[model samples]
Target chain A: MVRIQDLPRKNFLMPGNAACPGCPETMGLRYVGMALGENAVLVIPASCSSVIQGIYPRSGIGMPILNIVFAAAAAAASGLKAALEIRGLKDAQVVAWAGDGGTGDIGFQALSGAAERNEDIIYICVDNEAYMNTGIQRSSLTPYGAWTTTTWTGKKEHKKDVPLTLIAHRVPYVATASVGFPTDFIDKLRKASKIRGFKYIHLHAPCPVGWRFDPAKTAEVAKLAVQTGLWILYEYENGKFRISPLSRPYRDKSKRKPLVEYIRLQGRFRHLKKSDIAVLEKYVDEMWEFYTKLEEIYK
Target chain B: MEEDHLVLPLSRPAPGAMGKTGTWRNYKPVIDQGKCIKCLLCWLYCPEATIIRHEDNSVSVDYEYCKGCGICANECPVKAIEMVPEVQGGA
Candidate 1:
């Protein structure tokens, strides 16, 4: 069942290694890596992830991580899977753990190639919404009206729907997860790990640095990301789609918290006016409608 | 020899023997034992995994590699951890 309480005790990711304190990416990696267990190998691309794992030998992530270029994590993971299979290590999971820049922007081509081929690799994008490692630059995954080094005035475009794009690739397993909900995140990772063919797990990892929130509120931010419909938790497997437990109540617009409740929590969105909040609210409503229609059509 | 070193699968002479990283930290998290509820929040949120969760759920920082990012102090729900600026030469 992958209980949240059992996660910290598993110890896949060791302490006294490098990673910013209150970094949600590492927290996600710890939970996912523990759920995947000792048999898995991580393929990290150039991002905060590479930094989070530390500088090589002292890497905090307990699993063996194959660090690759910015846009080639999925490709390297595919190659690693082939090598391991040739060596007869078939059941082992080859995880492509990447940041938003790696998965949504620069690495999208290779990621699409892997998903199209249905490569037998478990791909997880731990999105913190910006290029946090190289300074908080705007990536395609950064949400609308959020500040970044490149988008000093706030990103004019909407956040890229990376997982939905993956689902369109018709991969066997596709899902969204949040680190705030450890049980849900663990359950999704465990489910994806057991399934074959290019499984996509999109984790909405919170970044205290880029998100401009108090480090202590990392969990609260992650939870509210779902409660406010800023990030939805759901899974699509074998053509069946289901909303996660914590996000189910939020399926209805009236039930969800106001978008301001989410925006006010982070400093990145502080520049936004009430009209901007209204824009995001409309965007959320459109997203909910889009998801509902997509589910119905697929169902 | 250069190529051999370059081709190494995972290049660390020793895992986590990454030298005294403690010297880099500008601040250190001091646990207020009296106020500590032993909740383990600091241990779980620590990126370095530098904090050790004891059998009794009480936690201790491993000074060997604790880079003092203040995640422990920041995450402690009971406000048990206080981040003190690191002073040179133990002063």
Candidate 2:
């Protein structure tokens, strides 16, 4: 029950950076700063965030951030945490923030190793679903039937279930959050901060430029992602699974919005034919079914 | 190896690090003070962190660095913020 007014007024992200006008990465980073405060060190890999922090000799963000190569964010974070402990800075938190390309594809091995070892770090994968900074290349997290520069028609493979993969490792905490629901995201961040061991938060951020939507519609697009069942918000902690309140209503099949409503808003899915949309709809159902089974088994 | 003598390639944190991004905006957001409920939703959603939340809980836009993305106007629950086109060269 985090209220809007109760949020900290201290902004970690400064006024002007290199992000686009209505970039979703910045939208999420604002809350990330609010929730984590000044004690965290962010390790960013090659992604939009790397550029968003601005050029050398001056950083756009207020806190300490280590910009690393494409496949080393988690590895760097693990080392950073160990170094902080050696310096007797036990209270400091090390956060690894990377895009989908870095998390699901490029840096998956490092991330997996860190998770398996139960590293004391918070790994946040801001999944915008593609290599957007590199001009819209496809990543494993890219949803099926969405067009990228490489996938001229549409991506044939469904999105990778990275959260489920993390769950298999039985980490201390794992949650899926959306930029549309900032308070829910904030609550998740706070909860993760309090917990020890590996924590992974998958933040669904819709890209206005790469996703081909109006800049002003960033929040709306994110909200639609949840309402349509394209993205489910939930948290898994200490061998327990529960759906977040914002998305609980959509668990009822009748309450969920049509998948087409979510797809029609983005130009990347404009080329999706009726048959392709049916495939997407089926995919969403399968995902929901898998989650429901997990809940039942865990319960 | 004294810390002071260690020449590290460090970048200090600075505001407007990418220059005054307000210049990139084609549209400027105008807040209608009367309609503002002081919810600070605009400040929360702003990507550039240009919206200023005051001590009294009232809000104002820092035009110097605001990119005028219209997100404030769009996310305004009461339509308190309006996006006005920037008139260049005294129109």
Candidate 3:
């Protein structure tokens, strides 16, 4: 029972790093690091995350980070795990942290290969919904109707369902988490660390700079994301779907915030029109309805 | 003196829209009518289309549709609108 207020105050990552203010990726990394503790080796890719950790000799995180190429994070982590097994040193947890671009786009092949092999490692994709490190370019995870450098008019396609993609692989554990829900995220990380086979954690990390939102509202924005049904918090364990109770439908419509509010808070979606917003709302409704049906069927 | 008015077209809400409805719990967008160029940017970008127009053509938030996401406040060009906390019901 990690009390939100009583969470350990020890700071593993130092300040003055490159991360923008109220960066969701930084928060997720911090909590995940805390959950895994010092007995972990992080395999990073060429994304905003790599910069957040800083360069060697002055890294932000306390653990040993193995910075790999843009698309080989999953493969590198698997290799490290195999090497550790060969050395008979299986005590430490090996984690591969990648951005949405690295995981959903360029790195998808390597990641799918690792999961298909059931490699023993934990993989977390800090999805800011776009390629933030390389200047707000659009990725497969960028939600439709949202603006980005690549999609100044708004992304025409819907966000790719990465969790369900992993579920197709039928891995041992796959969970969706957000820094907005720290306890839930930490719990998932802890559980993922202990699991033997491939585990996947998809975190919706808010990017203040890329999203063009205030730094202080990072957590608040993420909370609204889940509350609005734009981002669902759930897990699939051994082919069974366990939708987090936090994702319960908005029975009291009054209590449910509009998806527009969530969209407006971020600068990325500033240019959306009435028709665009309508399309996004419909997409959100359809996705939420689909997720609910999945929950009912699996329940 | 008449104020310079910027009338941003507000999207009319459809009947039977599904959204969180309360007395506008999370955000309360306060318009400083004095500074309002009446640009209506708040009305245009409202995700919920919660802004209501009076017969006199003044704009206000329809708490029924407002989710308090604060995009209106952020996009207000003249800083005429401020997002204050709703006195009741926010997570």
Candidate 4:
């Protein structure tokens, strides 16, 4: 197993890509590519990456990309890997890179099926929390009390607990990472790349445009997301679950920054009332408490 | 490479050049190394990959293609970067 620090220094995402400024998906994709090495095929669905990868007859992704439908990334990747194995190539890797809308909503069926079947694929769900590609429509992953074009007053429903849902299948791997934590993010991707059966990494990417935040604060926002316990960073491997070392400090509860500190930085929650924020805060605390219990049990 | 491919913009990494998006900027980000804690967040989040990381791990921006999006400045955890108005000179 290649050490996380020893991952190759090569740049596979290239420089001229069309991603928006301070795009977290671009950051996640770059690190994932670096850790995954170059001998991999990326199966992307219809999301922001589709546009960022460039217009037809011109592409920016250094490696090959198979752009599947809105809900077929994992299934296509499964088929691709089966075909590769049939051709006597088992060492190659197949990656399904999809946005939260694709993974948690539209493509959840295929992804669930792929994971249940133990397909040898790396499925990365870059969660920016909304359908950013389709003009910032709210998706199941959009956090509660966040304003999208469709949810002008903020979403009334809670964000889907996608990682736990994935873990339910007892897949060989399930992890939560954030663009703000590159080392942990890449480490999980590298570790997932080496494992067999199904692997999934729910990377919390920040969408500046959709979230109505300065394009430059994507990393900062993502960082605060984890520090405030609003986003949990943990991994599930071989029936064991543990919080990531990067987020271990927040286990003290006192070390966690306030949830308000994280939400106020972005404009999406501008319309949210204090009561709504309290609800969100309670939800965050509940999730963190759940993680703490898991950490204790795993330890 | 058939036209019926499922991937969007059915194309592999195309050759040739991309547009010179540098000219689109009205301001540019300037990194102050003294204030820099070497967090590397700016480098990691740079959409254009213009944040060049030296072998020594110090980072510098590639102004040749930067669009003055100020992303690096916004993401720098140490607040070591500043966005400055660009004075264009066509001469």
Candidate-wise lDDT, in order: 0.82, 0.91, 0.75, 0.83
Clashes of each: 5, 0, 7, 2
Candidate 4 lDDT over residue span B1-91, tens digit each: 5856665545667421255556666778898989987666677667677787777567898776676678788767788999988875621
Model 1 pairs whose backbones collide: A15-B49, A16-B48, A16-B49, A16-B50, A17-B48
The DockQ values of the predictions, listed in order, are 0.31, 0.78, 0.01, 0.41
Rank order (by TM-score, best first): 2, 4, 1, 3
Q: Per-residue lDDT for A72-122 in model 4, tens only? A: 999999999999899998778899999999999999999999999999999
TM-score of each: 0.87, 0.97, 0.74, 0.90
Tens digits of per-residue lDDT for model 2 on B1-91?
5887987878877888899999988888998989999998888888888889999778899999998888889999999998887986531
Please tell me what DockQ candidate 1 reaches: 0.31
Residue range A1-299, candidate 1, lDDT tens digits: 55434664656765545566567886787776667887889899998777755564455667877889998999999999999999999888999999999999999999999999999999999999999988999999999999999998889999999999998899999999987776787888888888889999999988988989877678778888899987988899988877767787888888898888889989999999888888899899898888878778777
DockQ for candidate 3: 0.01
Give the CAPRI class of candidate 4: acceptable
- Collision pairs in model 2: none
Worst 10 residues of 1 chain A by lDDT: A1-10
TM-score of chain A of each: 0.97, 0.99, 0.95, 0.96
Span of ten consecutive residues with least summed lDDT in model 2 chain A? A54-63
On DockQ, the candidate that comes out on top is 2
Top candidate when judged by TM-score against the true structure = 2
